[model samples]
Target: MSVLNGISVSVGPVLFKAACPDCRSRFELAAGALRLAIGGSRRTTFYSFTCPECGSAVRKPAGERIVELLTGGGVRTLRLHSTV
Candidate 1:
């Protein structure tokens, strides 16, 4: 876990499915270690994925903004920040 800015980031393994925008291909993405970049240094955590047909990533990481990572999609940065 990493604290970035004022947010507590949690990095953990995740298994998800991704749909290709171009090919409309549906695949699975599994992460060994979820990465969370925090602070000014942007320290990151690591994760891994294993899938026979999944050879590529569904989406990229989030930018300097706070975003929600969807199952198949990438991170979604919202206009407002909230913690549940």
Candidate 2:
């Protein structure tokens, strides 16, 4: 169980589907296995994980919806700060 914005949320084992372009292998990864990075712009926002099959470090672009889902699913997130 978790709380967000004063709302109680159920915490479960969350798994996300991911594919490795290098090996063309597709698999599911747990929330702890993934990392989300929110950047200053859409182009910079993305998620990353290691390919279980090939052990390749993979990164994919994450949009608004992806960010919401990932954050809600309990994936660790890092906010990128940009100094202009």
Candidate 3:
């Protein structure tokens, strides 16, 4: 536990479980290892990560639950804006 600005702050690494479709490998990834993109629609909303087992880049559609978990876990987020 640490104190910042006179407030108690607890920090820890956040891990998320992910599966790679190409390699069929399942593993846990730290929040820093994941990227979440929220777009205007479900079709555009997704998350991506590099597979540790096969070293392949994996992308998957993120539903409401997924979005909630990833965001709550402190994963980096990118908001997508449409050109139109």
Number of clashes in every candidate structure?
A: 5, 0, 0
User: Which stretch of 10 consecutive residues in model 1 shows the poorest summed lDDT?
Assistant: 39-48
Q: Between candidates 1 and 3, which one is better according to TM-score? A: 3
- Residue clash pairs of candidate 3: none
Candidate 1 residues lying further than 4 Å off, grouped into runs, are 1-13, 32-84
Looking at model 2, report the run of 10 residues with the lowest lDDT sum: 10-19
Deviation in angstroms for 41 in model 1? 19
Report the lDDT tens digits of candidate 1 across residue range 1-84: 879999999976555654555466666654322233232222331122322454544333443432234322342222322343
Predicted structure 1: lDDT: 0.40
lDDT of each: 0.40, 0.94, 0.95
Model 2 over residues 1-84: C-alpha lDDT tens digits? 999999999977888988999999989999999999999999999999999999999999999999999999999999999887
* Tens-place lDDT digits, model 3, residues 1-84: 789999999988888989999989989999999999999999999999999999999999999999999999999999999999
Provide the RMSD of all predictions against the true structure, rounded to 1 decimal: 13.3, 4.1, 3.1
How does residue 43 of candidate 1 score in lDDT? Answer: 31
Identify the superior model by TM-score, candidate 2 or candidate 3: 3
Give me the displacement of residue 30 in model 3, in angstroms: 0.3
